[model samples]
Target: MRSVPEWAQQRGFGIRVEWGRAGAVAIGAGAAGVVVIDVLSFTTSVSVATAAGTAVFPYRWRDGTARSFAAERGAALAVGRREVSVAQPWSLSPAAIRRAPFTERLVLPSPNGSAIAASVEGTPVVAACLRNYSAVADWLLQQGWGTPARPIAIVAAGEQWPGTETVRPALEDWLGAGALAAALLDRGIDTPSPEAYSAASTFTALPDTPGLLRTSASGRELISGGFPDDVDLAVDLDADNTVPVLENGAFTDHGR
Candidate 1:
């Protein structure tokens, strides 16, 4: 039995955490609610846009120049990479995105992971990361959240190589998912598998190595390549407690 299941067996809660797309897809297919994490920024932007009450038209820029496009359109943009620079303006906080009027459009540029998370729609989409795990869990539990037959799916945006098929899971995303799973288990939910526990534990046990961020594939590629500030922002935990929820075509910090 996995640690989460074991824990759930003892506590009577049914929560589980899984690693990778396979697990996430399984849960999404079976669950009523789904939370996707795109720490790099895409998913975050989607969550923010939805929370702010605007319909999101998620589009990918082949040249990765969405920022400029958004600027040209007078839409607010947030850089999700590490290292903020003077050349880039309109940088704002997650809270600001949540509080902004729902009509404003958001153009988010992250390292390379969050876009997939934006693809999930039919059901309400909420941003999930270590930063908002607790607040999100509380909100979910309070509503007696869950479809009797459908499970909740949490998708973590992993690092993807530009022209390759390889996509690596980031430590932060894994840890964030684990934390969310733990919170769900705390509320009497189903438990995840052994792999989930191992993944979460591995991330949690990291010793905070010097230049660890610089060494990470996503951090290194994005920072050295152009989005230095996004790495730092993505890793920040508990920066915002507001859980953005999707409503109509947009999202609002207001819980639905």
Candidate 2:
């Protein structure tokens, strides 16, 4: 793959939106901050844990090292959805985090959102979901981001195919990215790149966000996979106030 062209960076725009890891690298360049969206679960789970006053450590690989990564921090390692048991209840599922016994620190691993969040450096990284888009946008604006001088990059952590590295841009994440874009616009930060505008418009033009989320490909996957509560929590729009900001390799609430 070639490097993303200069024009494709959404340069000069106050708000930019892009898909997958490559998009994050492209738009993230020169931006003041990056907001990662994975509405199906990852970011939603971050919101749940952060709101509970827990710090989340985002890990890219789910291999054997994840356990050691958690162990080094004295944090609980999140298990697979079906792997959650009485001894290890924390998983990527938002509902699972909500029900799990409280822990001050947690290591959450994923190839999608967590990968994007953990990999981004230099600028601040924020975890945003439908549950706390408003708070995120508000926090960004408060920090003087989303301006011509300090642009904001919003990356939608699209899903990957079962056995491939190809990105499957999920509708839920697209809309989740748009939700924050729209909130930025509503808060008087009106300059969005064309891609960001399209995402924000898609969000505002929708009549039933909850319905759409419930029926999205990723959403349905969770429902059929016996984790409907996660989907339910992801659709809880503006339901939270905690904004998880990546600092020192962990997402700690920028508690407003």
Candidate 3:
């Protein structure tokens, strides 16, 4: 399990990392702010779609409910698969959303992405990957997400399936979370854990890597499945820093 106290102290924001299903629920229930990391593609696409001001209705079904719903409303859909490459510097524009009706939804079917979206039902949801780390940090600071009472929690969408070995924690997600914690600490917060510092320090040590896709489990899986280019796409930092907000059944760009 990721360390929550270290993040809380380091960022001066109340940040925690939960390891199990119950922890996911606790964070989602507004116990703290949540950041779900599914680096493979699902969360990334949701972030892009939401940042573009589109409503993202993430369904767990493989039968095409999300696609059909989006088609019914005329929304452009981005289909997600474990083997597809994550598009670089991707963005969904507000104009595109305007072209589609309410029935249209972006159907993102991934092992981790959709699950994270579904977890955070009523809290402020933002997509975090190596690509938008700094942008996300700056945006979070601007929004006071690291304030004392408002804690930030990162949810890593580990491999969830029958017969799959336990998904080891990815280095990038921890580092990304650490960087976020460090940024928060820079704003006069109180993060004191060595682990948090270590994670943030690791990210700073290697600033050249664009995003987490190159060094994450999800990214590796996609590559093995045939999308090697996606690793680079998901790691570009600050390429687009639009903060995605979940409302009703979709995500909207909350950036100014």
Q: By TM-score, how accurate is candidate 1? A: 0.65
Q: For residues 78-142, write the lDDT of model 2, one tens digit per residue.
A: 99999999999999989999999999999999999999998887989999999999999899999
lDDT of each: 0.53, 0.93, 0.54
lDDT of 3 at 244: 61
Distance from true position, residue 76, model 3, in Å? 4.3
Against the true structure, whose TM-score is highest?
2
Candidate 2, overall lDDT? Answer: 0.93
lDDT of 3 by residue, 1-256 (tens): 3443433333343555543234456454443457666544555555555554556665555446755865775554544332223331122222222233433246544445455666565676666655556666677667676544776665655555446635556655665566665665666656424544565566667755444446456566756756665555556555666666556656566666
**Clash count per candidate:** 36, 0, 15
List, residue by residue over 109-143, the lDDT tens digit for candidate 1.
44433344444557666667655677787777776
The list of candidate 1 runs beyond 4 A from truth reads 1-24, 44-57, 60-103, 109-114, 146-150, 186-190, 207-214
Give all TM-scores, in the order shown. Answer: 0.65, 0.98, 0.70
Give the number of the best model, judged by lDDT: 2
Q: Give per-residue lDDT, candidate 2, residue 212.
A: 89
Per-residue lDDT, model 3, residue 6, is 38
